[model samples]
Target: MSLREACESGKFVVTAEVAPGKGTDVEHLLKDAAIIKDRVDAINVTDLQSSVMRLGSMAFCHLLTDMGIDPVFQVTCRDRNCLALQSDLLSAWALGIRNVLALTGDHPKLGDHPTARPVFELDSVTLLDVIGKLNSGVDMVGNELKGAPDLFPGAVVNPGADNEAAMDLQIMKMEKKIEAGAKFFQTQGVYDLDAFEKFMKRIEGFKAKVFGGIILLKSVGMARFMNKNVAGVFVPEPLIQEIKDAEDKVQASMNIAVRLVKGMKDLCDGVHMMTLGWESKIPGILDEVGL
Candidate 1:
């Protein structure tokens, strides 16, 4: 089933993501995705994650289509204005891409190119509205189109935010995204299930499907770093200590991933696995999660 169909049908959808390398080398990334083609409903191609420049998500998505794997094209508003955004959206449709994830990308100052300028003319909410207009056969400014793309657009959320005001703002944006035509949402990394369950209760009335994002905790140090640096994602101290205490860190990490996915199955519509470099572990993880 298409990702959209799976989400709308309430099927326990599974998705993974891949970030392209710095150079033109995509063979490893493609190989990684190939292993999970049948296992995941779709694979998300990141758009300049952390504001790092790499191969464009649109091109990588087209490559995925060539491999017969569905791709969730991630588009961010940090680099492009409205015109370029619409143009790229049309370009993506022409390349046989049907799914998109709109994001307000990280600032260039956060990446290798610290001096680069940012163009945040549109945030995630307005970008969703642009997608709605395009889907309705009209441009952002009421211009009509000879053809329109049937894009199933989604957005990002942070249900694990520990801060009250931050969580409230996330809910408000969630509502705006839905009104702007977001069909689904993929959350930030979730390590604490009780907090996530509370978040689900808070969004009980939302009409959009939510996919709980699970990132593999590769090491105790990685967990500590994220907790210290990442704003919304929190890796609980116990889970961090569990990894630190384990002799086989990789296995422990996968175990934690399995636990998180299995725990979230009933609480959310799906799980979006951000496996980082551990794509090889996905099949085994799914097997552990009972598929």
Candidate 2:
């Protein structure tokens, strides 16, 4: 089934992240995608993930679509103006890309180009609204369009916020995104299932499909870095220690991911596995979780 159909059908959906290369060398990227293409309902091509410059997501997503794989084109609002953003969306539709994930990406200072200026012409919430406009045969400024893109749009939410106020704000933003025409939501990386259960409780009665984000922890250092630097993501001490004490860190990471996926399967409509550089591990993780 298509990702949109899978979400609306209330099935236990699964998607994985595919990061583009720093250059035009897409041969490796396509090869990696082929590994998990059949294993996932759709693959999300990240837009310069981590604010680092790379191949554009739209180009890579088109490649994935040409390869007969459903591509969820992730559009971040950090690098493009409203015109460029809208133009990209229309182009994506013309190229047969149906799924999109809107995001207010990381600042450029946090990436390879520390001296580069970042553009925040529109945030994710506003971008979601723009998608609705395009779907309704209009532009952001209410201009009529000759054709409209029938997009199954989604927005990101952070269920793993560090504090109560932050969590509440995340829920409020979720409400805005849904009102702005978000068909589904993909959350930030979640480790605390009990906390996520509470988050679900607060968002009860909402209609959007929720997908819990799961990032595999490769080592104690990685876990610590995310905990300290990554907003809305906290690696519980026990999980960090699990990696620290493991004889085989890779296997330990896979086991932890499987545990998180199994725990979230019942509460969420889907789980988005983000393995970063370990894309090949996704198929194995899915097999272990029986997804």
Candidate 3:
């Protein structure tokens, strides 16, 4: 079944991310794809994730599609204007890649190339509006396209905001995205179920399918690094302490990931696993959670 069907069927869908490397070689990408091919409902190919340049997400998604894997092609506005974005959407549709995730991506400075120029021509919210227009056979400027594209559009949300007001504002944005044309939502890394529950409570009436994001914490040090550097992601103090207290960090990390996935299964429509560089460990996580 397609990711859209799997999500709309009210089943707990499982999706994972695969970052194409900085080079043209797709060996690692295929290896990681093979690891979770059967386990996940679909694979998300990140677009220059973290603003760092790499093999294009469109190319990687096409590669995955050729290998008979369903791929959610992630498109970010950080690198493309509406023209290029719309063109890419049509290209993806022509190639039989249907699932898409729209993001306002991290700023260029946050990535490896610090001196790179930034582009914010259209934020994610406006991007959603653009997609809506395209779906209706119109371009961004209100001109009709020769042939419109039908995309199963999705957007990103962050439930781990530090302040209640900020969290509430994020939910408001999510509602707007759904109104604009978002069929589903894939959230940022969620560590606290209490926060997620609160966020979900506010959007209980909305119709979009929500997939909670779960990052596989590699170690206590990794957790600390993210806490210090990443925005909108918080590793709860207790979970961090548990990792810090473990004698076997690898086993501890795996246990933490499993518990999070199992616990989140009942709370959301699905889980988007961010294994970071540890894609090989996904099977173990799924096995532990009985997924």
Candidates 1 and 3, the one with greater TM-score: 1
Tens-digit per-residue lDDT, 1-291, candidate 1: 789888877789999999987989999999999999999999999999998988999999999999998899999999999999999999999999999999998999989888889999999999999999999999999999989998999999988766788888999999999999999899999999998999999999899999999999998888888998887889989999899999999999999999999999989999999999899899999999998
The best candidate by TM-score is 1
Candidate 2 clash figure, as a count: 0
**TM-score per candidate, in order?**
0.99, 0.97, 0.95
- When superposed on Cα atoms, how far off is each prediction in RMSD? 0.8, 1.1, 1.4
The numbered model that scores best in lDDT is: 1
- Residue 40 displacement in candidate 3 (angstroms): 0.6
Candidate 2 residue lDDT tens string, 124-212: 99999999999999999999999899999998999888888987788898999999999888888999899899888889888799999
Q: Estimate, for each residue in 1-291, the C-alpha lDDT of model 3 and write its tens digit.
A: 889889878899899999988999999779889888999999999999998989999989999898888899999998887789989988998888988898988999888998887787988888888888888999889998998887888999988877878877887889889988898888889888877887788789898999999998887778888898887898988998888898988788888888888878878899999988788888899998888
Give the 10-residue window scoring lowest on summed lDDT in candidate 1. 158-167
Lowest summed lDDT across 10 adjacent residues in model 3 is found at: 159-168
Once superposed on the true structure, which residue ranges of model 2 sit more than 4 Å away at CA?
none
Steric clashes per prediction: 0, 0, 0
Tell me the lDDT of model 3 at 240. 88
